[model samples]
Target: MTGSPLLALPGAVVGEGLDAGVAAHYGNPMVEQRRLEQGRAFVDLSHRGVLTVTGPDRLTWLNSMASQALDRLAPGEGAEALFLDASGHVEHAVHFVDDGGRTWLVVERDEAAPLAAWLDRMRFMLRVEVADVTAEVAVVGVMADPSALPAPHAADAIVWHDPWSAASPRGYQYARDPQHPASAWNWTELVVPRAWLSELADAVRSGRAEVAGVLALEALRIAAWRPRFATEVDDKTLPHELDWLRSAVDLHKGCYRGQETVAKVMNLGRPPRRLVMLHLDGSDTVLPVAGDPVVGEKVRPEPAPGEATERRVVGRITSAAMHHELGPIALAVVKRAVPATIELIVESHGIDVAAAQVEIVPADAGAAVEVPRLPRLGVRP
Candidate 1:
């Protein structure tokens, strides 16, 4: 895809890779981040993919395939859902809202095509009509209530207020913290006609509204401990691993593609891994990138006569950013056995950056039910 029209604005610097064709920053990132968090600025996320599912069976068809309870979702109400593979690995993270006639889905650019194809194939006898409208529609982001924004919309102007801040009904929170960082997270996305991209740029240029870029938006997301599909998911990721069950999974909902594994893990097992917020030692000028190895010392049986221990890779950094308020921070998915209090090392650019772990998903997450243990071997009488 070509760069968004917003890239023509002054100070716009194009991003790379997944963020390609979008502005990564606009001259000053920290200033933009502050204004954005204050709800005084908006971001151009026109680079994201948009999909629309219309028809009478749209809600029910989607409910049967996603993690959330979507069948009864009210018009204008925003929700998050996950599309999982049979084994319960997250395949797509979706943010959607219905505007009476059509359900608008906002997803990462890379997942858009594949997700649409998969949904299309599942349309057997359903009344739903799926269409990838990425080239026809655009998304705008803001950290404010939708009522006040004059974002351009098509026939159905839908605003998706993120539900990550609070636990969804029929959902479970794996993070033990009584006050999760997301409690203060207020994010919303506006679905508008692609042609209005110029109007939005005009608003920014005229100072009717301020503008921020991907870097600014990302910094706030990291500080809020929000898990994004493109950044946090891997081939082995279970929603439980990132505490995503609090918002994206309905524990008692009807069966879906990966419900069996979701049920088993919640009822009788633990997630093999857990998510944590890492406070990186900012003394080193370099920030770790995604996939950087997170190493920590662990005790193991010695090959010789004595016991030995060595630093081993326990996990990898899923995302990292420099927050306007928090210094250098990151989110990492590590083994369930990694101690919550351990200080780990993020190996990046041939340098080891020290990081202190703050637990997001506790080590004991899952196994929601209390089952009685039977006698071990023949020891019990």
Candidate 2:
């Protein structure tokens, strides 16, 4: 399990083994403490994907394909964009940076090659070059003051900067990582050079900054109501229903594949369902896993003692985690008309749990007004 050179970290122990799919899960107290109190941390996002687009027509080619308006991006600027299918469903989400002549698309590892292939296939007459650079580039997460790090692409070439702070300094920039696209206003990302990995890791470990584990990281993400690829999205899920239209879809952008469906949904104003956050009551004993059914009507049997009843089929849990500050929390997808205050049962791992009450925060509650939009493709009654 610890055989991989990349897995060797001081005081770090690999659990579930490398063959288990997860590289490692940090249970270190120091790491957990850093995540809770500092409000900042660094994690190994090496599993992410990076692709480079070069040539004179890079910006025009990407703008025409993605939902965001990439044509206007200047060098050193980045944008959150999405690629959609005929139904306006997200095929991939990405963070794109325009470095004068070259554009880089950062995505999730699983979607990297496929997205590259899609981009290549779409390169009909455009004079652009697209290549997967995941091997040459490494993606890492940094949460703190942008001033602390030198300007990206400086002498060292720091090409990516996506800060999460609501009021990040003028020099700092934040962009969406299409791999883990979320509508939340609190999430931010940065693309650093692989050469700086040692220094960054040491800085985090030495207490100058915080180091976050997967569990604590997931907790923070849930509290922020951010959506991830595996937990919140899939082929069958429409981007609008997931509230992806706000950040990933550009209504005013030029023609692109699947623009019709995006326009239809925006004009119609109704998606099949909406995503919501749930507060669980009996989550203390048994926690609900992803894909667990969320009842809407009638009580479902409790998997344990002292659990609530009277549940109806409302939605399903997409992500769940226990936070040091917020206790147990979850994200669910429910029918748009479902009452936000309804109690429900979420069954996971053969355990039926009581979800105290659901809370539906407006999709754009605190989001930026200037955020992009996707045109309504159609009305779904």
Candidate 3:
């Protein structure tokens, strides 16, 4: 399939569309990063997929299927939803925005075909139309002042403004720090016609605009402790584990796929595992990959068989990046019971790297950690 024309630029390091898609860096990642942080750069995320759902039943119908309440969504509003299997395992993470007439869905490129097929199969008798419009439209991510971008393609271009508003009304944050990176997170994506890439590319070529690669974006995302479907999810993954409940799942929303498991896990107990940010030591010069084992100093009273070593692999790195502000950082999935005080190690390929645990999902990650008291039968405050 053809992709964003900008990917052909010199020094553009292209990789799989999911992880590093367009460019790793346009020669200097640092300069590109500044431009992005200052709202002067954008990323060509057209490599991702775009699917649209039309017809009158779009909102109500979608509400019945995803983990978010979409029925009340007004025009130009956006929300993140998860499609899960019967057992509540997240199958797809959808970032969508609606313009009254059509609801646009953004997801990993590889996920488009399958997800579209499933949606089609589910639309038995509903007045819904699902179409993959990826080829006709492109997605460009920008961190610069979004207002500066041209208006959306009259009924064609749709800008999905991220509501990284520290916290949303329908969400709850497990990380209570006021200075969390997400509190300042800034990014937005613009959907344009496929042919618009050349003009945008020319702007970067003529020094009118700056182009930052996915690597820079990934670094910012990691620093912000944001989770992505491509890097952080697995078959057994639950939203709570990644503190995603703060942004994705609506606690009191109506039913949808995986609602039961989500409610049960959040209310009655903690997720079996949790997501944590790792401040990796760069001394070893080895960066952990998605599957790199994260071992912790064994504090088990009795080491399990084959676990006699002082440290045992307890988790794996989900995403890693070298940030502009923070040196080397990574997000890892680890057992919920793991102590936050433990020394985590990522030893792989003859590199022994030490990591400091910065809890994204606190060890006590549960929804009902505090119970509210019922007011006296007839008494008032």
TM-score leader: 1
lDDT of 1 at 294: 98
lDDT of 2 by residue, 183-271 (tens): 23343455656656556555645656445545555666676655676678867676666656545656666588888876665554456
Candidate 2 stretches with Cα past 4 Å from truth are 1-6, 10-25, 29-40, 146-186, 202-209, 299-312, 357-381
- What is the C-alpha local distance difference test score of each model? 0.87, 0.62, 0.82
The collision pairs in model 3 are: 39-144, 153-157
Of candidates 2 and 1, the better by lDDT: 1
Write down the lDDT that model 3 would get. Answer: 0.82
Q: Taking the tens digit of each residue's C-alpha lDDT, what string does model 3 give over 1-381?
A: 565678778788775536455667777776777778778778878788899999999999988988877888899888888888888888998988998899999998889999999999999899999999988888888874454344343245687766654676776677766788886677788778888888778776877666888888888888889898888999999888888777777877857888898888877778889889999998777788888999987557877887656767789999998877788899999998888888899876768899999988888666665668799898988
Per-residue C-alpha lDDT of model 1 across residues 1-381, encoded as one tens digit per residue: 455888989999988777887898899999989988888878888889999999999999999999998888898887899999999999999997988898989999998999999999999998999999999888888888653344433234568889988887789888888878898889989888777778777777877667888989888998888999989999999999988998999887968999999988888999999999999999988899999999997755555567566889999999998898898999999999988877899999999899999889886565989999888896958
Pick by lDDT: 1 or 3, better one = 1
On a 0 to 1 TM-score scale, where does candidate 1 land against the true structure? 0.94
TM-score of 2: 0.77
TM-score-superior candidate, 2 or 3: 3
